[model samples]
Target chain A: MIVVKFFGIARIKFKEKELHLEASTIKELAEILAEHFSVKPKEFKQFVILVNEVNINKLKMFRTKLVDGDVVMFLSPASGG
Target chain B: MERLTEKTALIIGCGGLGGYVIEELARVGVGKLILVDGDVFSRSNMNRQLMAKEETLGKNKAEVYMKRLGEMSTCSVECHTHFLTEDDADLFERADVIIDCVDNVDTRKLIAKLAKAKDKCFVHGAIEGEEGQVMLVTPDSKVFDKYYKSVDDTIRHSTYSYAVATVGSVQANLAVKALTGKGGKFENKLVIIDLESVFVKTIEL
Candidate 1:
């Protein structure tokens, strides 16, 4: 199982901060969130995704493979400074 | 420690996050500060802006904060009543570190580029409702190039003061750590903060 964490508005949308799910890649994880949140898959493309503390964008992005005990995080954009 | 007592800091905004950043930096003993912001304190800013008070309404944010800091602490503070642009590159040379408290993403890119060119460390912070993040970008890191997209949009109009204060405090802490080379953690990574869940997660760049 992979631990998927949500922050900010993502948490509110999902009604929880984290969950455990079975997934083999970041793409699959995003699909799970997309379905739960009722948002289009394209919407997940703009979010900042990290797998095990490393940004997926720097790795293989959605194609980045996951393993047991892996941790995934979804962070929305923050604009106020 | 007095390590930060002699260092100079440039804070790019004086709004919600910048006000608290300035307060902490001064209280922590940063010797000099440069504040920049073009807007005036409005009724909308009172919700989270530390510099926005009943008497400060219609007053320039940068000037008000500078005066407030001057009276509260011994640190030397300067105010620029305008948004930053290429013309302000010279200010970057005098600063040992920069705290990016600007709300606009395009300005963030400009500050990052200027910091790289000037060889100064840039400490970035941003917030939206219950969410915020902080990152330290040195000349070699090039963090903004990886984290930021060209598209500039802010979803939330205003969030609670609690989140802004929390994020501002973190931003000030990072700036101090960069200046002193102590208590630093997010140099090449981003620290994502969620006040609702009380989670502080750091992601590698």
Candidate 2:
């Protein structure tokens, strides 16, 4: 099981701050949230996901196994000056 | 300056995003601050800019920002009152962390490259319209080339909104986290926020 923190729009969508899921990878984690949140490509829920603060892309998503203490955080991209 | 102890930050703009980032950093006891901006507060900046006001219009952002930040803390706050361009490498050299609050991409590129060269931590926050995004880059990452994309790219769009304050706050959080050396987080990744969709996910670049 991994603990994921929702940020920005992610927080607004789920109406919950985070999720504890028994998943093996970031991809699985994303799919779980996508299904739970029912996100659509049309809606454009474009956020950069990080695992332990490092990008999930750096690891194997959906396939990235987790240890009991591992942490995941979902975040929104900030476009500011 | 002693209050910050181990943390020192350089804010590149005293505008919208910069104002909020500075407010939070100073509030949390960032020891030394260098506020760099060549522009003055303007009427158009009143929308979402905390430091921008009708009476403050035309006033140098660096000056106004330093005055406000000083009141926020007794720590050292230095105002450059000049743009953080290629010429500001000296200022960048002195920062332990650099928080970007400028809207233009070219300037972003300059600071990004400088931070990389100096091996400093760079925290970036951007907003266009109702959309905003934040990302962290280190001496080893090329995280912002996407922002320099053509003028029409989605990355270049920014908006003014009080509802979107969280986005900038997150960027500030990322910066502080890096400064504290508390852990390895917000490194080499972009956090995108679209208020319209109400969902956030991390896209690996």
Candidate 3:
């Protein structure tokens, strides 16, 4: 099980701030959210995913494994000055 | 002037964030500064850009900050009228700290990488609408990649004046603390603010 949190645009679209779900990897987690929310999987790919306070990109991209009590946050890029 | 009088800083971008960051650092007497920006002051910039005065309209942003810093402090201000790049890593080599006032995440990554390589403190700040965030990245920390995660490459946002000032002030404060050995609280954390709801959250990474 993992706790998934959303920020910025993801937060606005999901309507819910966070959710708890069971998943083994970030790819599975994102796929689950895409199905539940009716959003395209490609859109999910664009999100910056962080697992347990560490960026998934720093670990293993979407294949990073998740365990119970892990916190995953989805964030969008900001480019304003 | 107590602790910052001899410190040098590199400010990337002379727009909204840079305007306030430069002013705050100068006021606190950061004795050396490198101002980089490849923009001109347009009428629209007057709203939140502290240095974008009507009289200075059409003037180069970096030059504007250079003149303003010169008038406000005895800091040796060097103006680079272009965007920062890997080639500009030389600029960071001599600075005590680097401030990320640029709008894009790619540039922020460059600065953060250089700061880490040079063992310099990287004070990061960004604003979008009424929301803003500040973070302190030390030599060994990977906070930039952790928090941003290439978000700038895919998302676009606009900023507001209050958020810029608020976040820029925090950036300056962190820079001061890091430079003066006062210690930084956001080294492995990120402080996020939403002025619309008056909400602030600190995330420990």
Candidate 4:
């Protein structure tokens, strides 16, 4: 099971702080989350995805594979000062 | 503490985050501060901006801060009553550290690029609602490009006073560390603060 966490606007929008789900890659996880939240898959693009505290962009981006016990975080960068 | 008396920090924006950052840096005895902001204080700013008050309404933010700091600290404060642009790139060359407290991402991107070009330490701080984040950007850091993209401006996020003060204090602390030669662990990391949930953590970039 992967523990998915949401921060900033993502948390408010998704209405869930965290969820436990099973997925092999970030893309699959996004699909699952979009379905669970009833939002478009494209909405996930706005978040900065991190797998186990490391940004997915440093790995394989959306193709980054996930394993059991991995912690995934979806964070929206804040723009206000 | 004497080291801070010899260091200079350039801060962009004089709003909520900028207001707190300036106050803290001054209180800590940072030698000089160069503030740039074109905006004036509105009634809406009185709630969150430290320098915003009924008397300061409609006055240029940078200028107002300069006057306020002058009355309180020995730190030399300068002001530019105009928005920062590529033409103002020379300011980065004069600062020992560059801080981003701007409200928009485009200006933040510009500060990152300028800091990289000048090889100066850059500290970023921002807040939206109860959520805020701070990051220290070194000359070679690529966290900005990887994490931030063009954001839509249509949706305005509410800003709270406590959130602004929280993030701004962290940013000022990092800048002080950079100036005083104290190593900061926030390089290539984003420190996220959720005031509502009372959660704080750093995510490696």
DockQ scores of the candidates: 0.61, 0.21, 0.37, 0.65
The positional error of residue B138 in candidate 3, measured at the CA in angstroms, is 1.1
For the record, the alpha-carbon RMSD of candidate 1 to the native fold, in angstroms, is 2.3
- Tens-digit lDDT string for candidate 2 (B40-152): 98887787888788778899998998988767674588899878767678777899889888876667778888888788888877775555677778887766654344322
* Candidate 3 chain B, run of 10 with poorest lDDT: B149-158
Model 2: lDDT equals 0.72
Chain B global fold similarity (TM-score) for predicted model 1 against the true chain B: 0.95
Better of 1 and 4 by TM-score: 4
lDDT, candidate 4, B1-205, per-residue tens: 8899998999999999999999999999999999999999999998899878889999999999999998997799889999989888899999999999999888888898889999998998888788899998888878776678546431357878999999999999999989987746668689999988888998786
Worst 10 residues of 4 chain A by lDDT: A7-16
Cα lDDT of model 3 by residue, B72-172, tens digit: 76688999999887888888998988999987778888888888878888888877667777888888887678657646553445567898899899889
Superior candidate under lDDT, 1 versus 4: 4
How good is the docking of model 4, by CAPRI class? medium
Candidate 1 residues A1-81, lDDT tens each?
A: 999987654665566778999989988888887887788777777667778878887799889999999998877656787
3 against 4, candidate with superior DockQ: 4
Instruction: RMSD for all candidates, in order, please.
Output: 2.3, 7.1, 4.0, 1.9
Off by over 4 Å in 1: A8-20, A57-59, A67-69, B183-185
* Residue B47 shift from truth in candidate 4, angstroms: 1.8
- What does DockQ come to for candidate 2? 0.21
TM-score of each: 0.90, 0.69, 0.79, 0.93
Highest-scoring model, TM-score: 4
lDDT of each: 0.84, 0.72, 0.81, 0.89
